[model samples]
Target: MPLQKSPTGTWLPARVPQSTITLAILLVLCSMVQSTTGGYDGSMLNGLNILPPYTDYFNLNAATTGLNTASVFIGGFFGPMAAGVMADKFGRRIAIFWGCIITIVGVILQTAAQNIAMFVVARVFIGFGTAVDGIAAGVYLSETFPSRWRAWGVGLFNDFYYVGALIAAGITLGTGKWQSTWAWRAPSLFQGIFSIMCIMILPFVPESPRWLIHEGYYEEARTVVAQTNADGNPSDPVVLTVYKEILDTLEWEKKEGRTMSPKEIIKTPVARKRLLIGMSAGPFSCVVGNIIASYYLTYELDTAGVTDSTDQLKANVVLNVWCLGCALAGTHLVANWGRKGTALLSQTLLVICLFIIGGLSKKYADNPNAASNSLIYGNVAVMFLFQGFYSIAWTPLLYLYPPEVMNYSIRANGLAFSQFMLNALAVLLVFVEPIGIVNIGWKMYMVNASWDIIIIVLIAVYWVETKGRTLEEIDAIFEGQKHSTVPDVEAVRKGEATVNLAELEKEVAATALIVEK
Candidate 1:
């Protein structure tokens, strides 16, 4: 049967039930906590670094400060090693809950730290927990949302990171005048709130239907598919189609003896390509010069002649707000422009902005007194533009693109490995950025801009568009054969279409035999 279009010409039914919308909102809110907590941790550290009390209390120099900032990634580096196993073995929701619990413990330790050693240890835990939570949440969001809503659902997940960052920046800015350790400790203590929110919301949300099918809970998976996609109408054509597709795909995967092992990722040419593209989001996001602004904004601002602490804090607040707006806009862009197009546009603009900023900074930043006010201001303006463009594609795509491209068998593990690479590289760069800023000054931006030019080419060559396709349907792109056995929903609804599961299974077996022969 041919695929039929909705009368309303939208991806979903025009009049979706209110209950479905409510469920989607809840799932988005719950999944958003991982990024929100991360944003808060990063912005809090950035804000605290600017405060005299935080620097004085820790006795931080460039090296120690880099160690302190990089410690979270160090912890994150180890977390994904176990994140994949926990998410796959236990369940996505369980992994998220436990990860949040671990983060809360880290938050408590960080709040009461009397020495730098205690603080660093605490950050490591926070990093580990957040990493685990992040991978699970990314997979959960990608798996649970309907195909029509998946891009926005997963895109907004990381956009909320700015929400957490904005809050942390505001709190730290407000508390900057305090002459005590609480100025820094207060922000540290607040990092757990988002995790706690995630824990609270998880009970009200459903698990991924795909995960349910993978674990042999067919009825439960079907029920979830109906609840989320068809508003509890089990007989609805959309629900039936999705449910059947998931079943057939999983059945085929099993007959082919696929496993979730890492080795399976590199077992074939297509699999290797999928792994490379899925992992690309990690390092591409980290290497784009955002690290300098994310963790070392104060240092960057000082070099640009914004020497006052108050001014710097205010700039941090504005930058987070700006990034949030741009990231939200990017969610819409991905739907209209497609993934590859939006990324290409964003990367091109980033290169241009970074190049100009480098030139302006090199000319004026070294001699702020001798520089004209407009020249100094131009450098700052370009910096904001660079971040804004960065937010447009990289921020939303950071979490959205990776899981969409990977099949269920390796999605959880692939996400973990991608995150591990991100953390590993972040550990080095976050540590090295401050030193680079102190030693090489503005040339760092130039170097980073040059690197981004190459990234644009890689993205053009490697990334595939995943717009407007169901998770099971995406496998067709990778394997050059449609995995879904479901027919048209409209035909199914009219009782004009039927699927023969036994025949489908026989066909799959025959295909496998041909491959072996």
Candidate 2:
């Protein structure tokens, strides 16, 4: 069966159904729930520190405040490992359900906390619970979206993370009205609203068709693939073709006896390459210094003499909106530049921006007079630009790349491990930022700037392009087969090449024969 040529004379897959797009939106929203809250929760202390009324209520200084923020990443360090098991064993939907429940509990704890200890503990709970939502949503989107739209869909999913950040910033500005604990407590309670929305929607969405096929639920998987087809016709060639591909890919994995354990992932060649590529993104993203920068934005700006609390919160709103816009632009950019290309370009820009920010900050550290005004303004402009570059490369691809690279056998586990590595580094950076600020001041920017230089080199060498390919097709790229970096949607739609199961099965068998010889 072949794709029918439309009136426009362009070959394309059947129009993906509105239902599928709706599902994708829900999944993206699911991702945003935790991220928005995580953004709001993680940075709440930062906003509070600058607001004297709230700071007086909590009696938080730089050291104790850093500890509270560090506690979230501490739980985040372990959350993904636990969530991975749940996702692989129970299903993506169930993992997300449990994650939301735990997050709501964590939110409740934070909202009602009588002391700093209770609030710190609550951060850990939010970290642990929300980590699963982030990991599961990425894996779910990767496994389900059609090949042509996969990168764009995943980009949308990741882009919403800034939506969460924007929301958090808005909440900060809104809540700044009250001089009481409600200023912070209201936002802490607000995080639950998104979680509750997710919990309500989870029951309605279909499970990942790939997971169903992997689990031998062929009938269910077929139905899902059919239902999500643009035309919503199960008999559509595109639907049958995708269903067959899923079946064949699962059979091939079974024949190979591939291990799914995170512990085993590092030992397999293709799997190890995937893991490294995915895992490196976490540290590289951290080394770029966005997480630390976001958490301490208020402090950094305040130190620069943006002393008014409302004014500091307003600055964050503007910065987050700028990042959100960049993320929107990146979704379209990936089609032309490819994942690795976009990342290289983004990282190179980040390195230069960081140098400007660090150099200018260091140049003006001892002097706050009018003579240093240009340096201060330059530092601020570069800092905003820093998020712009990161949004282009890291923001959209952060969720897309890891899952796209991993084989289905270890997809959940691999992503979980990636998140684990991310939070582990985050734990250190989150803890280190305040201490570094107190002791070394603006020089901390120079340390990250140097780290970004190394990240640029690493990405140039190791990263592979997964754009314009299906999940199963990406396997061959890592297996040392020659895969095109060229975008292939036009070819697939024109029937020049189809990602059919029969073709992929034959390819797998041929590879096995070569290995045996």
Candidate 3:
């Protein structure tokens, strides 16, 4: 079956499972705070030059400090893969509940570390624990939200990380303990708190209706859908049709047309292409520029020939703050423009900044310390611009893309797989990042700049726009039609499929061409 769409101008009650929504929020919060637990690890690598208060604490070395930051990604790599399988086999709630347990153990290990090796190992465990939130949260929201509100629900997820950063910043700043490794430990303890809260209340939250049906529990499925729908203002037609559609969309498949196996998922043209598209998104969403930007403070500017510590520190601080400006711009433009267009514009800006900065580093390498800071601040200022463009275009919205490309039956698994690859890629980059700084000099930044340029070109060439679109409409768009019945407004009106007929027909015509080929 291709897809069935309701006529335009239809809206019904929005479905946001209250329990799932709350659990998703808490899960995201855990991730936000847990990530910042290693804030000082990056700065610690370079601190080998001067012994801090506990300079001999475990006889720390640059290699171990680097391991500390990189371990999170490494542990995170396998963690999500494991969690994804559990979610499919068990339940999202259970996956998250156990994730907290892992995190608590990791944090306790960090706090009690008597040696460098112990610290690194502990960080790995913590990474494993944190990874579950990414998969569980994404699926939880996707399952709980109606098709119309799914994007909005997921996009809001990243905002919590920003909030988490603020909280961490305040905590570390307040105690004046950022100088100590224990400053970071405080954040991890909070994860335990959050996990316990979610677990205590999870029993009250209903299971996903779709998942329930998939498991042959029709009574539970209907009960959940009806309850969730009753909480909202449902259109008469939507009230009549929503459950019917939900049941039809999610029926357990015994064969190809009815349901698909994981192997067929990778082999079928439509399914394979979607997975690949999601794979591309997984890397781009987190890698290249964003990763580099996140670790800006870790690298030493003095070796690049900046002699003055104050100036280098100021430059670094300014660069990170500038990212907020870029993120703000991204928040505004992401919805208005298509995903491809937003990504193109932002990436192009990043490329420009990289070239300018790379040239300035070369030009000023001899100066050591420039008294007049024009180019230093100006191009550095654009770094934020680079961030702004990325935030609006790609940073906040990529999670929304994976679910749209896949159909109802496999959207959860597709996102879980993409996240699995994403965490693995992040781990690889984190491990590689330390080597790049140690061996490359100014070349590390230059390499990322080059990567961003290539990313822009690839995005412009192959990436598709997915804003304000429906699942059926998206499937239609990928099929190659010129138009689709995707909606443009923020909120949907009751009973409306809200797609463009011309676009849908055009895309259908194009999809036919792909098959003909």
Give the clashing residue pairs of candidate 1, or none: none
Model 3, residue 62: C-alpha shift (Å): 3.9
TM-score for candidate 1, please give it.
Answer: 0.92
Question: In TM-score terms, which candidate is top?
Answer: 1
- Expressed as tens digits, the lDDT of each residue in 1-517 for candidate 3 is 1211111111211223344344344434433333333333322222322323233555545565456667767777778667666555566555656776787788778767667677678878877876775566566555655554555555555533434343433333443335665544454344355445445544444555555656655544545554444442223233223433444334312223534334444656777777777557777866656554454343434434444534544444454344444554565566566566776777777777666656665565546466246655554555545555556656556566676676654565677677778778877776676567667655666887887777877877766677665454465565564122334222323534454445444443443333223
Candidate 2 TM-score versus the reference: 0.89
**Best-performing candidate as measured by lDDT:** 1
The pairs that clash in candidate 2 are 15-230, 16-230, 17-230
lDDT of 3: 0.53
RMSD of each: 6.4, 6.4, 8.6
Q: Compute each candidate's TM-score over C-alphas.
A: 0.92, 0.89, 0.76
- The C-alpha local distance difference test score for the whole of candidate 1 amounts to 0.84
- The whole-model lDDT of each prediction reads 0.84, 0.72, 0.53
Ranking by lDDT: 1, 2, 3
Candidate 1 Cα RMSD after full superposition onto the native fold (Å): 6.4
lDDT of 1 by residue, 382-480 (tens): 899888899999888988888989888888888888999999999999999999988888899899999999999999997899887777777888888
